[model samples]
Target: MFGAHTWRCGQRYDETMTLTLAPDVQHHAANAAGRDFVIGDLHGCVDALRYLLHKVGFDAAHDRLFSVGDLVDRGDQCEEALALLDKPWFYAVLGNHEDSLCAVAEGRLARHRWYAIGGGWAQGLSDHALATYAKRLRELPLVRVVGEGETRFNVLHAEFFGDDADLDAGRFDAEVRERMMWGRELAFNAARLPHYALSPTYCGHTPVRELRQIGSQTFIDTGAFIPEGRLTMVEALTSRQWSISVQAARAMGAAEMTLP
Candidate 1:
């Protein structure tokens, strides 16, 4: 782990330099019988997600949903969002928020720090509950390669500082892993050189006003927790996209829908 330093966005956090149990990378075979969808940071908006899934006619029997992570935090449906992990059709990578939660669960990060950064929903939870959530989140890979050949793409929470070879081999050191979950260079500076991931990499830690792509990297976090923000979903193979504002999703009776 990198030296304990102030995190991005000028937020000061006390991060313990400890190794994580999660695998750095994981691979999934292409969906032969159904379509694959990649969604932006959930931020605990499970109802909104359900609404979008219903709007898209998602078939749980055949289709799969991949998340860029931050599945919990800043919204009222955190438990519901985390519950998605139990569904076989849902997959996700680890985001920085999850990382902090893990640290807190392990007593490496202070609880107040986590609360200050949108994890307030966890304030009253029992220690066992927090540990359980952390354990589940720790099982998530930092990066996921989905599909194969020309249709293949990568899903991660944030920037990858290394080249395609490093990513392919999962040769990430602590610094690389930290950058993968928290880096924002690519999101803020589109023209920066060395955008060299071989596969189309989809990331979501840094929310953009709209879907933005630089080289092979796509930023899909549209700030669903913000008043004017919306949740974005993209089909991994076809690059087709759909989005709905939080208000709009709620107005559509999202709360009444169940995950399919």
Candidate 2:
């Protein structure tokens, strides 16, 4: 973690211009002293998520869990993945996979396009479940800002575009919105990084062989969608980490079916 405290927009500014925090955003730490964990892209691996939580001794009634999103699609447990939205302690940012699912619901994208990109399991969802998941995804914010001062953590699905004004105002044009789901330049280009620096922002989109940390930005997507990959969960404040590989997940009988 960086020592210098990054400056963020004050809360007193005009309400209309500032993007409001996620509905679940903890204005004040829920436990103040309790643990909070952030998981990388899930991609419908509910069994792996469950095993990780069990391994961590997570207390759903107390501890909080934040996800980098892509909670659905690509895996066998898509239905169970959608159910996480109902968990009181769970919070998530919108990932590109969720973005595409939303687009499918709104008729902006063809169903086949979603399937081609590992969304075929959605076809198995009952109409009610599909609608319910869509509604839940609609409620998710593009960003989740947690803590304040040096402890401040920005949770987003992908890279943050350098737009303090638009973000502070809670307004994002099509480009900014698109970038949130698909941008990689910020992570791939070291020189383009400082321009967008802020409180440590945890994001997942570009899958890495392992966790990658550059300054305050941490990318934790370990390609859980691939059979050889693993699910990763990191305690936000403590930085305590836990992982469950695909083989381990299977050995634990985390899921009945294997990923494609």
Per-residue error (Å), model 1, residue 28: 0.5
Residue 253, candidate 1: alpha-carbon lDDT: 95
Score candidate 2 by lDDT. Answer: 0.71
Pull out the clashing pairs in model 1: none
1-260, model 1: which lDDT tens digit per residue?
32243222211223474543456688999898998999999998877798889989999999999999889889877888888889999999988887787778878778898898889999999999997787677678888988777868899998886656688788666677777888887777767667674688889988889899888888999998888999999998575999988789989898898888
Model 2 lDDT per residue over 1-260, tens place: 11121111111213465533333232434357567889999998787887788778787667888888888778777777777888888888777787777667656677887798888988866656655566667678777877767666777877776633334455665566666777777778967557555667788988888888866578899988788888899988566788887668768875653321
Clash list (residue pairs), candidate 2:
17-169, 18-168, 18-169, 18-170, 19-169, 19-170
* Residue 84 of model 2, lDDT score: 81
Error of 2 at 7 (Å): 31
Model 2 TM-score on a 0 to 1 scale: 0.82
Q: Show the lowest summed lDDT stretch of 10 residues, model 1.
A: 5-14
Give Cα-based local distance difference scores for all models: 0.82, 0.71
